[model samples]
Target chain A: MSEHGVRIQLDRVTKQYPRQPEPAVDNVSLDIPAGELVVFVGPSGCGKTTTMKMINRLIEPTSGEITIGGENVLALEPNELRTRIGYVIQQIGLFPHMTVRDNIAVVPRLLGWDKARITRRVDELLELVGLDPSAFRDRLPKQLSGGQQQRVGVARALAADPPVMLMDEPFGATDPITRDKLQNEFLRLQKELRKTIIFVTHDFDEAVKLGDRIAVLAEQSHVAQYDTPGRILAAPANDYVEGFVGSAAAIKQLGLMHVGMLTGLAELSATSGLPTVRSRENARDALDIMLRAGTSHVVVLDEQGDPRGVIGFEDIAGLLREEVSRVGQDA
Target chain B: MSVKTLDTAYQVTPSRWSRRNLTVPIGLIAAVAVLWLWVSSLNLDSIEARVLNAEAVRRAVVDHILLAVSATLLVVAIAVPLGIMLTRRWAKPLVPVVMALANIGQAVPALGLLVLLALWFGIGFKIALIALVVTAVLPVLRNTVVGIQQVDQSLVEAARGMGMRASRILRLVELPLAVPVMLAGLRTTIVIAVGVATVATFVNAGGLGDIIVAGIKLQRTPVLITGGVLTAVIALGLDWLGGLAERLLRPKGV
Candidate 1:
């Protein structure tokens, strides 16, 4: 199987537990490009985890083949193959007996790194995850809080710097604030690392926030839609996705895509210094730039950098005020 | 000459770091010293005479410790693997039954077990050894099973997914994490074995119990005190060692 860059192909994958009447995963086939963050989103027990596990052969596929980097994963020794791919989980299962350094150095040690190299790698990972290695190196898993431990978990997974990462709700167990911070931190990490990633989550909002392309698995592991976050939001493939995305599809779509791409040069001329509005004069991004900038009146510049639309605090405020007035009238 | 002088000075005056680390060791040695001194202050001639020509007392203490050590080592060798086996999926279903059996072994009177073993293996160290082995197995086995079984499931899954073979996972991850608790269990077993070895004198098993039993038969206080104090010390020693192992083996947080 000579393959293109990090292409993961799932060919007719199906799984049926012993004595079960139904297949947990139906005949599903998907092709994920290299260096993409693909989110597998679904309801509980819809086989998203089963599908993810099959990629690494953790759960043997009853019938199907998973190819990573153009090599059929089934051909590689499971342990040898798994060690080469990064894995993160919601439980953040840091080894209780191993210090943070040892935990992060696990794969490196298995691959026969000398003490100095393993130590250096561990220290590097701790810093990458935003923890100071000097303070945390000798500490045990039990001493850290949930969020800190999860950070270590992510750092440990990335220690060997594998080209691919499989994450199962890595941020799901964290509290909202910590989860948000971790999400942003992980995105930053991914931007730099560019590991081909398959991230699983039940949270659609999370899928929208993080995925380049989100694959919505409906009941019985049926693929409802596998498209860019924008396509899925702007034109849902089916009603299940619409109902599944529920009323928040628009809001979620806002996150899935870059505002700069959607807005034309014609649109940027209207919004004002939205102080938070960046120095960027992108036509599409000016809206967020205007909102976050919070300076009531804004100017959008044409290609010549001349003011085109003068958006006032009242126009933005009126949008909010209209909702308020509508609620007041309804009450 | 200055470097040589610094070396000499360092040897004579221990570093503060060394002193801090040695605190527990210092306290332990002090207690032992205090006990020895207190015993020495007792000027009772019978006891003093027995303690001075203490060949008999020495033999008894040595024999008791040897038997306890033997029992604990044999128990660990047998129990650790058995515990690992019992924690597997197929074997897991039999844990309650196996635990019931271990509990029954413990519930038997040590004297009764010794008699039964004597009938089976004949009188001597062998019967006593068999009895002690049976008595010591449960703690190590139970603790090993509990420790391995309690490893977080997700960690196991992560290891499995990473392609660490079952054997490697058991060796590198499962065993290391389980060690602190297992050591605690071993400590408990060793202390219990020392206490039990005393009762083996009934079967002509010459442990510290021999001196105590001899004192009872001869109506002598000196033999009894020597045997009793030594057994107490042995139990305390094993307990202290276990505590130290637990401290050393347990890691700080991530």
Candidate 2:
């Protein structure tokens, strides 16, 4: 009902398939704080998806205690519980026969919302996902492109305004350009909605870009490293976690630092005649601007267009060494 | 670009009147008119002295249409539910067996099947109806099962994940998607039944076949030609109507 998110807890969860030597998911536990996005990242068949599905009771856990907003989830009827939670999948499975409006209205209609309320909610959702309601409401799924259908998929999942959302690679099937656009739009929406989301993706870069916290899973879904993206990139627990992180460890760490987080900042008097990046942008964008302008520093703008400070090439370089030296000292 | 050229480019093509869309109905009317004129001009005094008069032909045509229509309605009522049941998990294993039975229904000749039913029910409209139903139900039932099963599995999974009950999912998602295919099957059945209903006249159930059978008995070629032409026209007319029904029932944007 509120824009705030709810807490979800998975305590000692385990899923073992019949006749398999190893369990699909070993004894695992995680505490997801309210209003934060936690991403589960690992390889295919590593059980990251299985862990996320268990939250919605889509795939019942073999043995575990799961709770949402302090209520025991296992005791509730699955269909009833599902209605209170939003779910989206990689396939963007819109019903081909139903119009876009009806597809987005499925949950509300199931909840027995009245005709006027459902119509209003559907149009609002279409707009929320960047589709013009009047133009798209009557069109069928087959009429839309893949990217448009994915937008409709997100709209449908959020129709009833559930507090918690479970997403399994929701934009995985789109082309690179569309996927990037969708990811940016989704991030903007999440900032406004602040829903408790447990997103599962095999792409670690996506995990780093979107997650407030990232959980890297090993074989049998064992948590290899559970920490902030900056910390995980700085210090992987073991070889298994490192392998999933791949190369460019320092570059990935740059994505976690915002322009506003920089200390020892120097002021820039002139706001124009130089490339400007926003205060909320990552170190990567600032670095790109400095490189393109062929200058030592680029103006970092505040909420308004005025320049607040400047970030130099050394400033970006200093962030990488800041953690490396700290890690060295600890060792 | 110049405004004069732009104005010229925007000029619309003059619309022409077309009877193309009305061709099917117009053709049907014309065929009926020609057949009626030919029948009236015939010197059928010899035939009229017997049972091959205009009154008899009218009765035969009406009886033919009624038998075919009733048989199609009954087939739709029975076969659709049977098809849906056979698609379920518990009933899936029974599909091969049911299809084999339906194949047998079509494999045996229509007259042969009618005679077998006639022995049990005694020769009349009931036997003719049963024969027509058995001969025509297979396509609709088979297509219904295949259509429902072929719907994308992810759509159903998405529906379930969104908390739709199984019954609601079937009614809202599965049935609507399967309709176009089901209508195709229905269209096939109606056309086949119209042709097969002609055999009912041999059992004294009264159809266009009565005129043809009487003509053969009396060696009257004019009566025979009249019956053959009427039967063909009715079959073609049923096919056209079936096409119209399919177009009307189809879900838009599919």
Candidate 3:
């Protein structure tokens, strides 16, 4: 099977529970391009999960249509459709009685893969999730730490290598440190897999960190604003989205930019004493270094730690201003 | 950490030869030996000798075991599937009604139930088997439902989300997780079966109950002691086997 994702389109989808006046998700429409991570950010009861579930028909829509890769979702068997879409949830529900190998092999076994191939795939997946195959293959879920179990959850979802993934706050239950670590590892993995993913979360900061596009949702699953993180932080479409962006919009915008984006940096000199920041580090980190050392400029280093050039406070500030005005003009 | 340390840290499987497992069998052997010695010491008259002889004692012991074991197997066959059926979404409404009937089966005394069955169906091993099954079915049936219900709902949803059919989920996920509790219930049923099998002689189904009934009617203490001691020993021995089956049959890491 090809590892790349296919486009998903939702056309005026609505979910109305009987006896409820307002539809849980009312006439929402969206288009998600292949190989992008779109986050659904909203309050607890805003029907964001309901909207995502309709893609795989976990919660069937009351009206309208959803298509993945241009085939109507409602036309296919739900079990068949779900097999081709990876799903992960906050609870990290690993089957307790099965060994890690057996747990990861569930989907492949369902697909009727041969025993040798299943074993090979289980080991490969365990390695992909950063668990040592020989050490962990025979262990049960309760034997692992919470972070480790969550990693296995992700690996299990990816077992069939589905083109689309739906994650509902997959890291929500972990401790803060573990959550941060899992997010970083997941981001690195996603860079390579490039599956079209709908990540549902209430945390706007998480949306800013991981989402390629943010769909800020309001009551009854209304899409308040749908844009990139930089745009949403720079120019929120309305006060509802502005409230979500909060007061730290400028700093959050800086976080979206890297030092390598800075232009016309002064050439580094051997005698110049300056703080050093990596080129891949975000602009916010460079600004923090300048603020701490009471210096306007810090030397930017490349991958080999060689001095590439110097960036000053004005350079970082200019990047943020340029982004804001650019989005402002678009609005 | 080294493999040695990891092994020690999660030493979940207790050793098969641990004290807890060894004690029951050893105590049972000692009890049997004492009972044998005590019986031999009694200078028996003809009636005591007739009741306590090897052929008669052996027949009674064999009959009792067959009665208890067959009844237990029958109870398992009837109860487990019914319990599983009751837990399904469409069958949920039947749960309370079935449980009430099972409760009534348990609430009636075993002797009374046996006599009633004997009156209706006439007396034999079959009547006694039905009586034992009716008396012991409640625990296993109740436990089967409870065991499946107690599995984490998220795990079921996870299985469903992964495209597992309902039957596949029941077989692979639900049933394996439910094994420990189901086996515990079976253990209780075994003990109940053994206790109730002694009452089988009341309906002309031969067992250790015959010897005890004869001793009481004939007013012979030696016969009573032999029958009573042998019945208790068999009960303990069967319970030990049940415990061992529970530990062995339970799915690993559950």
Interface RMSD of the predictions, in order shown?
2.4, 1.2, 1.0
In order of lDDT, best first, we have 3, 2, 1
lDDT of 3 by residue, A104-200 (tens): 9988888899999999898888888899999999999999999999999999999989999999999999999999999999998889899999999
Q: DockQ for each candidate?
A: 0.42, 0.49, 0.59
**Candidate 1 local lDDT, residue A226:** 94
User: Model 3 off-target regions past 4 Å?
Assistant: A19-21, A267-271, B1-19
State which candidate, 1 or 3, has the greater TM-score: 3
lDDT of 3 at B187: 75
lDDT of 3 by residue, B60-172 (tens): 99999999999989999999999889768898778778887887887899999998899899999999999999999987888788778778888988888888888999999
Candidate 3: C-alpha lDDT: 0.88
State how far residue A284 of model 2 sits from its true place (Å).
0.9
Of the candidates shown, which would achieve the greatest lDDT relative to the real structure? 3
lDDT string for model 2 (A71-178, tens) is 999999999999888899989889877899989999998899999999989888888999999999999998999999999998999999999999999988999899
Docking class of 3: medium
Residue A35's lDDT in candidate 1: 82
Query: Using Cα atoms with residue i matched to residue i, what is each candidate's TM-score against the true structure?
Result: 0.81, 0.89, 0.93
